[model samples]
Target: MFSSIKKTTQKLINLGFQDDHANDVNQKHVVNFSYLVFCFGCFLLMAMSLIPFIPIVFFVSFICICLAFIGLRCNYLGHYARAQLLMPILKMAQVTLLTLFYFGSESGFHFLLLHVIAYSFIVFRADQGFTKGIIVGVSSLLFLMCAFLSLKGVYLTESKQNLLLVSVFFFIAIYFSVVINLVMSRLKSANQYLRVLAEKDELTGLSNRRKVLADAVNIFADSVINRESCVFAIVDLDHFKKINDTYGHEAGDFVLTKVAGKMQSVIRPIDKVGRYGGEEFIILMPKTRLPQAELVMEHLRQTIASLVIETDKGIIIPVTISIGLAPISPEVTRYEEILAAADKGLYAAKRNGRNRVAVSPDFQDGN
Candidate 1:
């Protein structure tokens, strides 16, 4: 029975202190809701602590419960940051209240301060104000001094050993908080690096095929789920194989890298471009129609054809890309199918002697 209770307690700790991450605001709001619910449960536990002391305990619990409920409701109403910030403050207040219940700053429940430290690390993050750090330092020092005064018989404390132990544990809590924060900061840095690497094509610094496909899937899903619109385009370099065969692989790499840079210069931030495969690229245009997507692709094609790259050997490498364009509609059930339709248009561009934008006839008819 005791072991079962221990397991349940561990699960609750995991739910309360874990870091929940997301790329969307809605998901972050959900995380804030989950945290507030945990705070509600904490308030319940605090109320039970004062069971024999009726009215006062009921009032405190009622206030806390109200705060938690308000925070949860505000999440749906779009006050995400406020909801996130309030829960931690509520937790810190609870810890502060526990500290006041014991004399000489000695209480076994003082270990609960660890939750405050963890919450600050998670919520405030590195870029936030240092006020949390200041609070922690001042409170810890005040508790330590109180413990010392109690040992010197200047204050009340029936057990010197317990007070000393609690004081020592408080300092230990500080040490653990610092260490954990440092480690988590490192992990967050490493995570950011990994994310960048995953999204970029290492050789040319363009978006990779995998990243592009992921974006397409997400964009398509969002479009269908929300009844939004988007367009997909494929660009393939004209005579790319001949260039590789004529100028050697190094020259080919230089040409591809330069072309990617030119494309990046002209595209909008909301538009995504990726190296789809050898000598080919794909783009996703959210909230764009077929005509708009075609115009954008035409501009990109002309820009690529006009730009001339001068090599170290004074060789001017002239290049152009053939583009196939297709807009996603409600009828298209899969991203891959949309891509295939674009590929068909791209093949037509290649057949029509390249360096131009070709729209899928199938898409036009459906539209």
Candidate 2:
């Protein structure tokens, strides 16, 4: 039962969000708030119909429902800026001009205008300071106007007026609570995305040098303590600069992204692969010895050799890689030592031939 309720609520919140804007946080918030406004309009329409029917109140409720529908339609059509401006303006007009004028201040409709001030700030981004100020300033002035108009007279009886005021206050509290929760949730998601950007390579989508090295340090320490074997391999694309010079940087970027994806697909889940630097990648394999690591690197080298990339200009490009492996032995103390050994092996591989794997001489005797 709880699951069904959750799913239904989610559907309503996502009512007007199409696939293009599905990942947009601000668009999602706008859709959710628009849903709330629709529900509010329905509630008002039903309540006013059941009570002592006032024609003007019923008309206002109907207009609210229409305005909410129009706002949602605008969002569905990807007119986000239009929808954002329309919702607050329509809502403010309905409350301050219509409801407050007809039902008087006793109805508590003026309180909703105050919520519009905060709502405007949430919908507009920080960079949109001028537009945000205009919306907030207008809403504030309208709220003050309502406050002054409240002293004129009361239209409904004392009992009806009290009920209406309480209901309005209740809805206002719920609206603000939902808005605050949405803001906090968006902030958390934004922070997580920023962290990923920091740790990830922008071009190839691999772990950056810092993150991979950090993991290598911890893995190295664990291997030393448990007397386990760990392999560190440096893989460099052969003649990468030549490819960039011949095919252009766009083609170079395409090859790098494709190669990174292929390498990630071939490596074990426990192994770490990171873009160490330009045209160079680092692979850390824990609990793996020299021979096994060599075979894995050989497979990766062959896989890359077979890859054919077609550039936008209809040019075909084939690539190959050289790999160097260094196994961590009991004699190894720091992770940096293993990295240095790997670098030596990489140079040997490049010297011997571009498309081969070389093992560090220091660990060759141990293997």
User: Evaluated with lDDT, which candidate comes out highest?
Assistant: 2
TM-score of each: 0.54, 0.86
- For residues 128-221, what per-residue lDDT tens digits would candidate 2 score against the true structure? 7898899889888888788776544366777767877887788778777877877687677777878888899999999999989998999999
The positional error of residue 95 in candidate 1, measured at the CA in angstroms, is 32
lDDT values, one for every candidate: 0.69, 0.81
Query: How well does candidate 2 score on lDDT at residue 318?
Result: 91
Candidate 2 clash pair list: none
Write candidate 1's Cα lDDT for 1-367 as tens digits: 9999756644533332333343332224234534544455456555554644545435555676778767666654767666666665664555455345432244444444555455555555455557558645655654454444432322334564365456546544654554455456546866887898889998779889999999999999988998877889998989998888988788899999999998988887889999999999998998887777878888898899999987889888889999998888776999998899999999888888889999876786534
Q: Which stretches of candidate 2 lie over 4 Å from their true place?
A: 1-24, 31-35, 97-99, 126-131, 151-159, 225-227, 246-248, 312-315
Name the regions of candidate 1 deviating beyond 4 angstroms. Answer: 1-172
